[model samples]
Target: MNLDTLKQLDLDDREISIYMTLFRLGPASIRDIAGQTGVNRGTTYEILKRLAARGIVSYFPKGKRRVFRAEDPERLLQLAEEKQNALKHTIEQLKTDIIPGLHHLKPDFSSGNVSFYEGDDGIELVLKDILATVAHQPEKSYSVFSSKSLRQHLYRPFPNYTTQRIRQKISVKVIALGEGGEDAEYSERKWIRTQGQPDASYIAIYPPKVAMISLASENYPVATVIDSVEIATAQKVIFDTLWQLL
Candidate 1:
């Protein structure tokens, strides 16, 4: 049996070793299991107690010594089912209790928030945050200042972002700074005449937050997220003004 899978159930290396040793030796005392597994007797006894609590091992009296053995392998399936149920309950509790409580703790405009991120992975996180925020809002439309260079950098890491956004029924209005992006199911795009392909920077204006991503330097992609209703409102006004001329 591949013992690596047992690690997913929170078993440590010593626990796995002792359990496998008992499975092989059948109803053996702690001293025999410890000897076979090369672990000290005290630690082996502790692991046996934990496995018994997990219902994967059991013990019986063999004279003055206690004999430990692995329970039926089928017991592993039962344990997995229990873990699944526990995870499901946890998700429900978060949705009903935890998330709402956290939202209530959000800071107002008197105290604005600023966050910085670096590299491709950080950019992807910003994009996902945009999607998640839009998903929960009453008005799901956002405006964007898009650039060809920035799109190329992000598409490699998040190829399915547009698809996911469309699936969520989120909509975007974009002013493509240079050229080479197309309108998708839930998006509208207008192009601005530029001398050449514009430098790689992206600005997204979603109410209460504005995200700026710079991918102009291939080796040093970075992003900044600002949470302020005032800043977002100003950016939205500017985008709308430029959007009308194009």
Candidate 2:
């Protein structure tokens, strides 16, 4: 009998052992359950009471003695459902109460807040954040400084990022620092002439945030996101200035 499921329902070792013993033995006396599970009679009796309270174990009078039995195995599903419902209610409470309360404790900073992420998954997170942040903006658009060297690695983590952006009706303006980039729906691209290999950095300017993605090592990516209205607006101004020149 797999007891892992029972363990998740908050059953301790002794309680689970006694419960399983009753389940297998069928209508056993307290003394018999204690012996089978190697728990003392006093502890065994308490565990049975706890399980009975949970509606998983019950007792009936067998002559002068009470015999305990496990409820149908299907009752475990009911326990899981109860846990799920309780979690749902807790999540609602957190959103309305706990989260806002915790936010109040956070330090208020005007600017220079930065977060870092590493590897392909991290790059994907940066890309997703860009889309999500831009999608909610009044104009639903953002600006990018794209480099040819980092462009291939940038989308490896999220190859369908463009598709998702177009689906959301979010547009992007790209100032390409090197050779190649594709034009797509809801996007505008401009190229810059450069000597030697272009710098391997991609910068995105979305209001209230700017995300920069680059290589920490060959084929290994890292991203840093800056959260500040002043910095993002400055970057946006610079990008637009360069955009007009090109």
lDDT of 1 by residue, 1-246 (tens): 688998888888888888788878989999999899999999889889999999999999989999998999898889888899999999999999998898779766443488998887888898899999888899898999988877777656678999999999999999988878976999999998799777888899998899998864544778889988899999999999988988
* Tens-digit lDDT track of model 2 for 1-246: 577767888888888888788868999999999888888899889989999999999899989999899999788789999999999999999989999997677565533378999998999999999998888689999999989999888999899999999999998999989789998999999989899887799999998899998887677998999988788999999999999998
Residue 102, candidate 1: C-alpha displacement in angstroms:
2.9
Give Cα distance to truth, residue 237, candidate 1, Å. Answer: 4.9
Q: After superposition, how far is residue 245 of candidate 1 from its true place, in Å?
A: 5.2
lDDT of each: 0.88, 0.89
What would the TM-scores of all predictions be?
A: 0.84, 0.66
Candidate 2, TM-score vs. the true structure?
0.66
Cα error, residue 74 of model 2, in Å, equals 6.1
Clashing pairs in 1: none
> Which candidate comes out best when scored by lDDT?
2
Evaluated at residue 153, the lDDT of candidate 2 is 89
Model 1 lDDT, residue 65, Cα: 92
